[model samples]
Target: MNSPLPTAWLEIDLSAIQNNYRELCRISGAKVAAVVKANAYGHGLVEVAQAVLEAGGEWLAVARFEEAEQLRKNWIMAPVLVLGYTPPEQVVEAAKENIRLTLFDTQTAIRYSAQTSQRGMTVKVHIKVNTGMNRLGIAPQDAVEFTRWVSGLPGIEVEGVFTHFARADEPAADTTDRQIRIFDEVLASLRSVGIQPKLFHASNSAAVFNYPQAAYDMVRCGIALYGLHPSPETLLPATFRPALTLKTRLTSIRELDAGEGVGYNYRYYTSKKERIGTIAIGYADGFRRVMGNKVLVNGVEVPVVGSVCMDQCMISLDGIQGVQVGDEVVLIGKSGGLQRTVEDVAKEWGTVNYEVVCGMADRLTRRFIHSNDKKG
Candidate 1:
């Protein structure tokens, strides 16, 4: 017996991810670290990480220790960096697995040192300087001092020093340049005291194109790795192809006469005789209620005509011809000459592309497509 078909599914092209990694590498002219945090921004963490590694990417950065641990569990031995906080208790396990951590707080550094020292192991750490982000990181004025203090610890190795851009995605904003100047000053301070770490990086995806000068030793490619522009103002070249496509099949269709109501609370009403379609996708599948406005059927744009439910939604097939039950409906991806991108969906949802993709529910089955697969 075969397993039941998924109502909605995500098709992830691993080849597209690899192509994007190579493009980022060519553009940045630096070692590109693939940011696979947030489950590779909801593209399947292990699968995306493996794809990047196959594409000559050596480093994998995640937002938390658990993500790094998951990578390790999958036997992915790439140099993994936890870009966010790692609990004091997990420092030892992190060290044992050879995971690099972002160090900013003195108390956390002290705990890391103690844990590593007690275990007779040394853990590599990247010092994060708060170059105007005002989020995580040591104050710029105190970065040198903190680096010196942390360097003196018995089991902690200051392997890298980095900062994050606050507004690199905005081309007209001067915040990126200001942050670059501040970071350069911090690097100069560290070097003056002979505390130059092996790596110095400050470029995120947007900065990779907007501020190439800030691409120090390595560049962190997150959204771009998935072929997404960092922001509306910072567009990537046309060559970067999006790796994921959302699709579902129409399950049922019904003819509704004029004055008929549809969906919960009767939010939609038929103005004329219309063919309504019910697809096997809804908010539970990451198609939010607000997105009930449009989808693609037979390469034609159709209007979603009702309040989206938890497991289903309704679309008006009023003039579309030859669209039958079980015909493929595209929520995101190209259909004929028409294309719906994450950015397009983001615009409809009043959010960013990152949230639109990352918010996809885990229940939605992911089917990876690797066109270049030669392992067989």
Candidate 2:
């Protein structure tokens, strides 16, 4: 039996992901930990992680324990570092599965130590230092002392020390330099006291390019892994290719008279007699209502008219020739000579590319496409 074709689907290029990983490796000249959190920025977690490993990525990074557990469940045994909080209840389980966790506070460390000790297992942890991003991690001034204290706790092996860059994406910001200096000082202090973790990393995707000096032992590659630039100021080389393409099929077409209202609340009305096409995709499928103004139909740019519905949106097919039902509509990807990149879509939504890609809904099917295996 064959499954019905999805009305809308995302085509994920695994080869592009692999190529991006290789490019990041070449740029940083360091071990790359592919960041697969947020469902690989909504590209499909397990598939993306496997693609990274195939690209020679030695490590996998995620924001939660459940994500790491998911990888384990899928038999992805690569070294995984949970870059965010891990609940105390899951500490023992994490230890048992050998999932590394990011340690920032004393309470969590103590709890992890107690839990792992009870289970007769030792859990590897990375100490997160707050260089500039105050969102998480121990303060810079206290990083060394905290590292020493946490290293002394039983059942906890300090495997790494790292910091997150808040402004690395902003090339002109001197904050990244200052943060690097502070992190270096903390590393020096730790070394002076003979408390050095095995791995020390401080570079994210942006830092990997803008500030190569901060690529300590490894660089965490997140957005770049999905072929999206970290920011406007930091872009990957042209050799890197975007891995995801969003597409749908035009389901219906109708003729609208001049001044005819369209969609909910009549957000858009025809100024003249026009051909309107309805696409089988909308906000419920991760295509935001605010993101319907423009789409690609048969390589021709079309204006999405009116308020986008939950499951469908209308595009003005005026001036387009010989359009018919089931025509391919590209929301994000190349069509003919024109291409709509994720960055372009991000601009339309007034958000960063990270949010645009990561916000893709789970219900939308993801068809994995590999260069050697095009069957997907």
Candidate 3:
């Protein structure tokens, strides 16, 4: 419709995303709040958020105030929660848009309350507890007093409480269980003092699958909603379908002599006479330089020769036949009967799947394919 965007682009299946969200709902058995931060982990924020809302997501959670602002600007009427800090100045504007803020400290809550009360409005806040992750959150010991204080502050509504798990993705890690115990103790303390928040969510994607008991009033899912398992080591009864596919057209093909080298500094030299192909995608497109030796082409693993360029990379297509200059090359996704999952790329790059997907650059065109369209 738009003169066909770039050949190196991303295909997002909205249906698959919906399915993943629904699957998480079933797994958590609690209200699901779709975590749509980092541009929905590079799956296009607006589209992903729309799909989640269409699929019964109780609310949408983003990692920043600006993300929530963008969602509102797009006319997303569903409840929006900012999971991270919102500077003191942005509090009033955020409240005006009905965005909920996460409160990790009493002073911040007091400051926010002061702003909201002045405008004759109240702001909803979710209390963050530092069970063990210790990244961001008030200590569990001070949570009761902290929450109690914030709950009484003018224009502050303590609506929810949540914690993050540091080792939930590790299949054998008991650290997640320990975090849950700490969170439960905090919750019990809160309730004992009549400070029970309406919402209690502690399970992220990993915890949702691994610890059902941690699913309190809600579960926040990020990667799992994008159809990639939280960790490759995760064990689950149901499979999650990946929703994003990275594709590019083969731009060049040539034969290389045994002594020839490829790319800058000759990072890769031909072991023998070989066929090499250039793809119109590279680090500039979010295909990291480190990904040079770790990509795939149509189910067949190929060596990324030489240094990855800003806009292109070379791969050895030595033995593959029936190849052409315009053939489709899959960097991440299924091809024929073989597949290269996001997890595969993540492991190869020595990073997490979240980085692999979120690292997808915005320059790559995004094409949406519906679940129904797939069958027809």
- What are the C-alpha RMSDs, in order, of all predicted structures? 2.1, 1.9, 1.9
Clashes of 1: 0
Q: Write the per-residue lDDT of candidate 1 for residues 1-376, one digit (tens) a residue.
A: 1125767999899999999999999999999999999989989999999999988989999999999999999999999999998888898888889899999999999899998998789999999999989889999999999999999998999999999999999979998999999999999988999998989999999999999999999999899999998999999899898999999999999999999999998999998998999999989988999735689998889888879999999999988888788988999998989999999899999999999999988988898887567456
TM-score of 2: 0.97
Number of the top lDDT candidate:
1
lDDT of each: 0.92, 0.91, 0.86
Q: What shift in Å separates residue 236 of candidate 2 from its native position after superposition? A: 1.7
> Candidates 1 and 3: which is better by TM-score?
1
183-286 per-residue lDDT for model 2 (tens digits): 99999999999987889999999999899999999999899989998888888789888999999999999999999999899998899999999999989887
Native-referenced Cα lDDT, model 2: 0.91
After best superposition, candidate 3 residue 332: deviation in angstroms? 0.5
Structural similarity to truth (TM-score) of each candidate: 0.97, 0.97, 0.94
Q: What is the lDDT of residue 353 in candidate 1?
A: 98
Q: Going through the candidates in order, what is the number of backbone clashes in each?
A: 0, 0, 0
